[model samples]
Target: MRTPLGGNNLTAQQYESYPSADDTWTVSFNNSAGTSGTYEVYAVCLPATQAP
Candidate 1:
């Protein structure tokens, strides 16, 4: 779980991981500093607890 938010123009980023046997988890992004921008992505899902 990584949350990095920047300001003075805004540049927020987040990353989460849960992949090895593959339970499906992948989120990639890249603008590479090309002009023209508009971005807002959010995902909050929590309901997974099993390991006893």
Candidate 2:
């Protein structure tokens, strides 16, 4: 799931899936304007199946 970090002030583009045994994911962001600032990140887990 991709979402914005901070309303309009700051934001995150998207969440990506990394190679892992379990259902794991990652998200990243950077200051495009080149201004010092702070933001928050949130994550959650959804029902999924594990391949054999």
Candidate 3:
């Protein structure tokens, strides 16, 4: 997902998912210019059998 920053109003880039045994995942976001910022990213992982 891409989201616009609150102040700069620029779209943030995001990457998600990493292989794990517990059905876990990761998320990262950066500014439009490819700079890391203070943006907050939240993600949730459900059981393998409960995922959509």
Candidate 3 local lDDT, 1-52, one digit each (tens) = 5454566645565655565555555666556675444555555655557557
Query: What's model 2's lDDT at 45?
Result: 64
The global Cα lDDT (0 to 1) of model 1 is: 0.48
Q: All candidates' TM-scores?
A: 0.30, 0.41, 0.39
Model 3 off-target regions past 4 Å? 1-7, 19-24, 34-37, 50-52
- Over 4 Å off in model 2, which ranges? 1-24, 49-52
Candidate 1 residue pairs in backbone clash: none
> How does candidate 1 fare on TM-score?
0.30
Candidate 3 clashing pairs, residues 3+ apart or interchain: none
What's model 2's lDDT at 32? 65
Q: Write the per-residue lDDT of candidate 2 for residues 1-52, one digit (tens) a residue.
A: 4334554554334445453446555555655655455555556667789999
Model 1: CA > 4 A from native? 1-28
Range of the 10 consecutive residues with the lowest summed lDDT in candidate 1: 1-10
| Residue 46, candidate 3: C-alpha displacement in angstroms | 1.0
